[model samples]
Target: MTSSYGLTRLVLTDFRNYGSAQLTCDVRPVILTGPNGAGKTNILEAISFLSPGRGLRRAKLSEVTRNNEESKKPEKEQNSSLSWAWGIASTLSTPQGSWDIGTGLEIQEGKERRIVKIGGEILKSQTLLRDYVHVLWVTPQMDRLFQEGAATRRRFLDRLVYGLDSMHVTRVTRYEHYMRERSRLLKYGGADRHWFDALEARMSAEGVAISAARRQFIDHLLQAKAWTLGTFPQAELALAGQIESWLGAYSALETEEKFREVLKASRQQDRESGGVACGPHRSDFTVTYREKNRAAAFCSTGEQKALLISIVFAAARLQNLQGAGVPLMLLDEIVAHFDERRRAALFEEILSLKMQAWMTGTDIGLFTSFNNKVQYFRVENAMVHEKSVLIKM
Candidate 1:
């Protein structure tokens, strides 16, 4: 029993393309199939909000609210139809019982804010979601992950890190805020040396903490049995950064001081470049295809996707083994490009892990093998209907 609990119900209101949709599921992988642009991915994005961050798209709070275009008459009717306070609520069931969880927008002092609630009680911040569930995802847009910017890769790794360290996001947010403040001051008002010292010190402390958590996560990942020899490539992981390297050789305090000095001395240089010289923000998450001894970016397109899946699987395995609980997987258009052999292998791995993954696609045939293994659903115009008999492609 790799997973003992799962999201059994999901309700959407004025979110994305759905006017109102409700789906009830069990402890099984969920497959959502429909034509393109029929709101397949929208369902995954809604489930993502149940966890943390800005869902998968990283869209702003106001952006996810629905805008009704069907109402052509009476402009006021259209305005009334559009609900700015969109919501996502669901029931998470486990061996013990079920917990009520949900999140939505609220207007406080005329400013929109995201709210998270569990068991009918609102949380102070989103970071606390870690205690209840851990969410990890892979989207078709990430097919070119290795070839793209480091920011995307950082986000992928941070989502994995959140399973182990709830405060990682907070630390990252604070560190970036201080770094931005320092940059603005350096360019416009670095005359206050005391302020500079304070910001740099805070950045150094938070940056070092963030880097340390990543290092520990990588170590724990390797130590765990996530590399449970399967069809997926056994990818090697490494952190590439000046700060990450320094932490390897020096103490935490010593490394923080070194980073602080780097920031202090790079003030003029940073101002000219409009970016810090070196920090976790600029660090890279590196992966290698152990079988081919080639970096992920250099591997074939298919191989790159395989490497990403390998990392996600390893993280899920490691999290469960460490008592952190198995994470729910969100795979959007995951099987379209995978070959039959690989596809079968991927499904086997998911079943073995007993992971309750939510997967979406445009073809019903792509998921025939999952006929009995998953809870099937077909999406039509923002509505979802569970299928008892899945027609073969």
Candidate 2:
């Protein structure tokens, strides 16, 4: 049961536009189609929240509540008792045995909390859910990927890593908190040289380790580029980062010390600018087209879209090879750019990987080829309903 728990069931109560939503899929790809603003992306965002961090919305918990009560009146007269809830089931494996870990999300006016229970016993920390489910996603927001800052790409990279390695989250979280503390102290005038020194030392060590994990993840992803391109016929992926170039030259400990020393030396400059001078947080990826041998940023909009799909498929292949349980994929308005040939190939690759995916588009014809292999649903007004088509394929 644990082996095939990618998305067994999802229960939503007063969540977003839906008063109640009960969805079940036994680990197969799913296609969600509907007109624009039909709540297609909302389904994916709900699935994303089942994992660590914010959902695909990157929203605060309080922001996810539905306005059923609020919409009944003017914004100024609405009360703050509005709350929303959702339940997700995942598989958690331990040395002792494999068990089901179900989680719930509850949110009200300014507070959001996650509740977890394994098989039956209520557990502390939604982190326990991390043990069972690992999630990765790509949305329309990522369409202008290369044009964006490093933080977006770094976050995309981390999500990929998190799907493959759970511990990466712990490492990343710790590194971030450490950096925040160091930044706060640096902002204060009373901070001593030794205090800053020790904090930087810790940040340096964690930062290098975090960077290494990211690079290694990219290396694994690169290994699948050929196979990925052969199947998708779109774009190529190449990791670009100063730290990636520096990985083999030094050990982790040595890298940490070097980073600490560099930060110490750059303190005055960073303080003056109110920003960290250098760290893995500044790292980013470079996407390109293989046939044209050109960067994605310079490519046509259509070409960029194709390149992104190719990269996503490549990552999916890597996930399968890594035995990272079947990944739940989300694509928001990605198929509109693809020609028929590329669309068919996309379906083929997703089917071969045996992944559970959710894709959206306004044109139902875009997913007609998915018959016999994909579950099709039409989304409208926050209601996702299965569509039975009579078209002959």
Candidate 3:
């Protein structure tokens, strides 16, 4: 039931540091090796956009566009002109067939808007890309997730949930929107009770859905019986918050009702606090090493990294088991932390999964074992060139 689809071709236009680049390769692991700031990670970020959300970096639309280079033209001409926008295009090969997918920024009325197209047809929403391809990523920024505040962990958990449940994003977005509106009303004072009640009801429904989706995704990962990699340790995950704690005591409908009541009762306190104090918004994602039973935040940095990688690998296996399709994996500077033996084991597991994995590294020797098996590329000065010969292997 694993997905046979992978990105067969990728083209970037004015994306990040890349002015124009195109890559054509098989569905094998793609190894990108170059010095830092060579735009290797930027390439992975572009591929991540094929899915949903603001991408791995969580970068803004304006930040993703190529910077406008200083033009020698007159100042008046420069004032009237706009720089070229960015775009990403890829050919996806699925079990059923192959399709062309493209996403880019378009200027409409002096504002840049993201646009998506599938098989030459424009899509109204970026969520539609999920139907064609699912993506999962591990970035260097996420290495310290456990030590960060609850908000970072919550976002990480939500992304894990979103990978399996596409609709989860919609529910989370609606809940956040209503929460903001409720906060504004509270801050301004003289809010109507009826209006407050309506907002609370909608927020409660969406909050319940968000919590349920997170629980379901975690449950599925825990229930999966996939073989664990010898180099990676399993992680025990749990959620902590007022709403998450109540989930066990009440049904979803009951939870929604109870949540609504709680919101109503806390309106005065919320008004004083300038925001809603109790709901899914305050939830936290907690993880521990299964073998040692030690909290992830207390584990050694290396151990914590292993735990995170294990969770992502297990999640991928669960997705394959559920016939949800294998997702493209974006591993940014992930190999530099592992020794030769662990790196080999990681490569073996990736091969077994049969999904296209894009890995980045500064040293080519680190990826010598994958010399002929992977499609090797050297990135320099925002330019990407495929290497035909093995480098010292």
Report the C-alpha lDDT of model 3 over 269-366, residue by residue, as the tens digit: 99899988788888988998989999999998888777877888888878778777668999898888887777887887787788789999998788
| Superior by lDDT: candidate 1 or candidate 3 | 1
Model 2 Cα displacement at 13 (Å)?
2.4
lDDT for position 287 in model 2: 66
Candidate 1 structure quality by residue, lDDT tens digits, 53-91: 888888988888877875223555435533336889999
Taking the tens digit of each residue's C-alpha lDDT, what string does model 2 give over 1-393?
A: 123435656666555676667665555677788887887888888778777777887886655656576334355434546543545555533334556665566545745677677788876666555666666677778777778887877787787787777788878887888778877777786778888888888888878888888877777776655355434544555556555556668877777777888889988887777778778877776667777889878887777777777766677677777766556778888878787888888877777777677788888788878775776778888776877665577
Q: Evaluate residue 130 in candidate 3 and report its C-alpha lDDT on the 0 to 100 scale.
A: 72
lDDT of 3 at 40: 93
lDDT (C-alpha, whole model) for all candidates: 0.85, 0.71, 0.84
What CA root-mean-square deviation does each model show from the true structure? 2.9, 4.1, 2.7
**Ranking 1 against 2 by lDDT, winner:** 1
* Segments in model 1 whose C-alpha atoms lie over 4 Å from true places: 70-83, 108-110, 187-191, 390-393
Better of 1 and 3 by TM-score: 3
Q: Choose the strongest candidate by lDDT.
A: 1
Ranking by TM-score: 3, 1, 2
